[model samples]
Target: MTINRRKFLGATVAASAALSAPMALAAGSGKPRVVVIGGGAGGATAARYIAKDSKGEIDVTLIEPTRTYYTCFFSNLYLGGFKEMDELGHSYGGLAAAGVNVIHDWAIGVDRDSKQVTLAGGAKLTYDKLVLSPGIDFVDNAVAGWDVTAQNAMPHAYKGGSQTELLKAQLAAMPEGGVFAMVAPPNPYRCPPGPYERVSMVAHYLKANNPTAKIIVADPKPKFSKMALFQEGWANNYGGMIDWVGEEFGGGNVEVDPNGMTLSIDGEVVSVDVCNVIPAMKAGKIAEIAGVTQGNWAPVNAADMSSKADADVYVLGDASQQGDMPKSGFSANSQAKVCANAIRGALTGSRVFPAKFSNTCWSLIDTDNGVKVGATYEATDEKIAKVDGFISSTGESSEVRKATYLESEGWYSGITADMFG
Candidate 1:
């Protein structure tokens, strides 16, 4: 919970010295300090792996505003009442144990020419190498009449935290037969199948608590990840309780009246008791300020995750533009390993091995049923290309679904261990 300033500063100094010592020795004697921005999946994984693998040779400092992280992967279960908030939250104690310098602060901007990151608290950190994984920032203008303040009434819940809690509360307090509308974002968003999976979980909760309640999905894309499986599951599990409007049906277009909880599409204004509008997203503000992001996402070399705009900097997670990789936490964690290895090699002047990465994203349809999509990728000519993968098959047996559910939980534990523990 609360980090003691003396203890935290002591740990940070120790961690930094540990990381920089090896690089310093390799360079005929000065440690190389690495400052990693963000402490979610990518940043935490990179910091932990670098500190552990380098054996205190590379000084690693991690900057994060929050003391804990709530994973978006399984957040749907929280809405379904299958998991508690604490179950989805993870702390950074493991990183500290691994000798990572965890700085609880927000990065305001980066001085690329000087290799320094400016913190919101007016601290400037110099780094031999910088890794940024600040995650996504929602594009408020993507949806009309929806801003930060307006979102209080129609919660997006896309990024977790208070928004997620607010959405859950609204769902719980809805009238017995109230309508809940979810407007899913367009392509290239975090967790391609997340919105549908969320709808399934909400429907599951409604079927048990408020049987007459209805859930509607206004999808921007006609086809989604695990489309067949989701459609099949929805029909069999909650028939007539869920309605889906694909792109052809004007579900792809969305305009919001946050005050009225209404969505205007195809010249029609439909009112809902509760609305969740997941807008388009881009790299975090830090990335933009650092000149690493091109449009909405940061562009990095696939082989090393080094920013195309700045070689000394690397970007990962939903913030990076890894063409073949989905913006899932699993992908971010995997990319962190690659970034770690690259940083180690860069600091030590060693041969950097070819990078290969893999990701698996699991979505819980309900408490027991789950579906997954996985893939392996490699870098070629500075671009990532998927080599193998499979989306879960439609109508899988209950036993298989149960197995996937267990596997998903195992992955969450394993990933957390890899990143923090």
Candidate 2:
């Protein structure tokens, strides 16, 4: 699963090309408007690109309730104490400085017929094109006997803010040699490598403070992304400290007793000191309110991430049902660029490039030990399809691993800057 240097360099060039500040916008008579909901990787990038690329020809408004965004990606490192809370937090001031109308409010309803969005603040915003990247909401029945109210006890820590701090505190409060159990989510969740990376980081923390602490992962999925590399790292670095049970082993049949802090799998009860129950997820509530979601996620056309249900509306990131792409920030950012290109073209008669997408996922196994998997994609008539892909292999030199980790650090800085400003 190693990436050849030539293939890697070539792909890097093409992906970088898309990130270049867009060309001078074609002059248009009236400014077309784009309203972006949820200022995360997708929404922020779409707003920035449309405004920056359109060069004052497109009025971009962004709706996000939170003034600061804490990224779910790399939050695992924060739990492991490898990163500070401020490192994960980002301010919306940068977006505002970039000429985006940053509104701190919730979007309550969508009237597609009139191309209007109703906000919780009792205001209305009309847009010629709308971008929705509202992230995820948990399914009520995804985990039996566990609901939002029970989340305080067995923290999911999936959203990467206070929940992350809560999980970190729980880890620190665990008595020596105590058990830490997790109920990993099913397929098509944000950051495919995230749960496993969290496990690695937890193991790292426990080894230093609670050497005998045990971790049990009851995962509904039979296998996860980067399984081989993660298993090897576990064996090498934290042998006998972690146990992973897949669906065939009844890991999917789990129920929690929050009062007792018990996790039951296959009718077998296991008392746990700390519990992490990540449930199956669906599109954010706004997507459902907008009537754009089909089943659990919003369906979109591959060409420009436009909603299949409504042409003027586009969905990106974890909320989209686009094919062959994992629910990742990188994927969302890539999709936004494509959507921006199309929107700009429609609004100002600007040049529309072919929709080419790329994503790279990096996971840290230990300090200076990281691994990655990536692919280039194309928008097909039916779905977004993979073009070429590569991954870090099982056996690599320490030099290569360190370099990979450093590469991820560089990417984190660059992508955040791209999204925020």
Candidate 3:
């Protein structure tokens, strides 16, 4: 029906009110009821598209804990003082207006055999097909003394929301010439270049206000996305203001005391003005309970994002293990579109088209300057493979960098619109 933002918001309100309505009245006796878990990039997109493209033949229910979502994609700009939190946060009103049932609740568990989801409120929802995109959960014991309580003392801020705001506050409160420590997690996490991008953003702020402030990146991996480019940029721009320690230099070392505001690396205790510890990650707890996660992430067929463990369930975004595709928001959003199409085809006995996906991640080195990495992929034999893309050229021109920034903004708008509008 060509729904836009205003119409989408109206739909969300109507759908929310209909939640208490009788099932027959809510479904209207024809549409198939599809329940979606989580309302970030993956679930929101799935709900919007399934409701819109199905032409009222499908009733979509979205379960999420929050009404608003703050994206991690452009959060670095917020840290650089170039953007406000409101600019990064988006409301679910648009999705509501799209005829999707938006429920503000956390899903406690899923019954794969019965095709039902149980919420903490004792509400039970049965679905013909279920889509899960619950995102990642941090591994508390990845480092000693690092747990839920420890996270407050050393903000990971990877998932955005309160943790993000806390990290920002800590940065603002740090003394001049103080130390900021960032412990980058191992590979297969939500965002590979996120820690480094944050380093650049914080360095940009420190250079102007606290020039003597230091940023130490203790990375588990020896190399990271666009390592050479980031190194060159830091050396030329920040001039020794940032130091990166790879695995060779004891960067992999980690021990923490949540109460003492101290971290030990290689048995040497170090105290910093601020600390950001990004622990290892796995699929959300629900995914584990549903028997979808193999080790840390759920395994799915690349062609349709169908869970190998359960035929009726689909997993996308950071929770699924899609080879050659980094767990970034752009990738998740793109994958959701593909998965949505696959679900529709499967339900209607239509031919499911082969899947192709794309991703782009932009990181700002400073205001008015940024870098990007992107890739396009095709699925074959249940695995995704990269086709083509570009990493920002080293020492690219000002015009090129600016163009990338604009393109990234456009991508964010377009992807969000595709999911919610």
Candidate that scores best on TM-score:
2
Which residue window of length 10 is worst by lDDT in model 1? 1-10
| Winner by lDDT | 2
lDDT of 2 by residue, 246-339 (tens): 9999999999999999999989999999999999999999999999999999999999999999999999999999999999988998899899
User: Taking the candidates one at a time, how many backbone clashes does each contain?
Assistant: 11, 0, 5
Candidates' RMSD to native: 6.1, 3.0, 5.8
lDDT of 1 by residue, 1-421 (tens): 1112343344434533544443333564667899999888899989987887687788899999888888777788899988898988888888988889898999998999999999999999999999999988888688777776778888889886778889999999999899999888888898888999899989998999999999888887879998888888998889999989889989877788987778887668888999998888889999999998888889989998889999999999899997799999888887887888789878876445578887887888876898888888999775888999878888789998888887777777666666777
Model 2 stretches astray by more than 4 angstroms? 1-30
Q: What ranking emerges by lDDT with the best candidate at the front?
A: 2, 1, 3
Candidate 3 local lDDT, residue 205: 83
Better candidate number, 1 or 2, judged by TM-score: 2
Q: What does the lDDT come to for candidate 1?
A: 0.84
Q: Report the Cα lDDT for candidate 3.
A: 0.81
Q: What are the Cα lDDT values of the candidates?
A: 0.84, 0.89, 0.81
- Sorting all predicted structures by TM-score, with the top scorer first, yields 2, 1, 3
Q: Write the per-residue lDDT of candidate 3 for residues 59-111, one digit (tens) a residue.
A: 78999888788887778778888888888888889988878989999899899
Candidate 3: Cα lDDT at 142 = 87
